[model samples]
Target: MQIENMVAIVTGAASGLGEATARALAARGAKVAVLDFNEAGARIVASEIGGIAIKCDVASAEGAESAVATVSGELGAARILINCAGVAPARKMLGKQGVMPLDEFRRAIEINLVGTFNLLRLFADAASKLEPLETGERGVVVNTASVAGYEGQIGQTAYGASKAGVIGLTLPAARELAPLGIRVCTIAPGIFETPMLKGLPEAAQKSLGEMVPFPARLGRATEYASLALHIIANEMLNGETIRLDGAIRMAPK
Candidate 1:
């Protein structure tokens, strides 16, 4: 479907991949909603993109409901929902501290897996009631996963499991939402130049980038956003998890 004037909600839009997506959508004439837990950052992004910022914890029912309500009141029903609100905390199941805290694993699942489903469920329900566009598409949902989901390295038990759950969610979600004209897809990205990675030493970052089989560098946020736009434009592309990993199958650490 055409993005022009379409109401789109991008979670975790304060920075990184989500921020890039929000900007890209707005640049294409979509009315975007910048949703993030960082209210100030969200507001900054929203202001710059001419969108609205809503503080939301995508993992919580109340938070999701309130965010959806705010967006609906301000921007109309969202035709696109981008799930980029996730945490990537690397931890071993058994560390020097002993067995990993169960809460740590739960937190990862809550934000990365459950948060995605929560937002998608809310968005699908709203999109189903809307009139289909010229392409007979009511909405599109783009979820973010990670290469770690497939080749989980050492010290990534929690992070990898959460992302794998996201990968597992894609096809079933697409099948269930297809009849309602809502498409669902997931993007499993390799190491990117997000703030999280930028925090590392330059040598460490470069070493990580060199791990990619080709291009020998980190993936750019714009590249991910470009693929997302393509997915939104191409209706036939659904129920699939596209790996934006630069041919890099991660090695077990």
Candidate 2:
């Protein structure tokens, strides 16, 4: 889809990858709706980008529906949806602290997996109604997964499962939406320099960055956003999960 004059909804836009994506889209002349649970941060970025900020909990069906409805009423249906909303709480099934709580695991699935599907469905439904562009494409969706999903390490039981669900969803969703000219793609990122990683000690962060096989650095949010823009523009790219990791196959911890 053309970025100019297009409408996009970027969930989890409060910080990290989502914030970067919203900024990139807005900079490209797209009208972006910054959706996030962090009202203050969302508002700050939205104001800066001349976009609208909608406080949303993407994990809830009602919340997702209401936010999407509001965006449609105000900025037109989003032709591009970048689902950067997700949680990564690392915990082992049986940890040194004992087994992780069931609620913790459930919450991870709810927010990461279901939340992704929630926004995706709403965006896909709305996009389907719109007449296709010259390329016979209606809209595009970009989801965030993680390297852990492919190779779940210790203390990543919940996070890995939720992310794995996203990758597993790509082909099926793309096939289902193919006739409607809507594409579904996923990005399984390696350790990125997001707030989550920055929270770790500098030494710890450096250690993780060194784990990458190439470049030997943490991935940048702009790099992911750039790839996402390309995916949206490339009509032939559909129903695939692309790992944005630095050629790193994670080893079990």
Clashing pairs in 1: none
Highest TM-score: give the candidate number.
Answer: 1
TM-score of every model?
Answer: 0.99, 0.98
lDDT by residue (tens digit), candidate 2, 10-61: 9999899999999999989999999999989999999999999999999999
Q: Which 10-residue window of candidate 1 scores lowest in summed lDDT?
A: 88-97
The CA-based lDDT of model 1 is what?
0.96
Looking at model 2, the pairs that clash are none
Backbone clash numbers for all candidates listed: 0, 0
Query: Whole-model Cα lDDT per candidate?
Result: 0.96, 0.92
Off by over 4 Å in 2: none
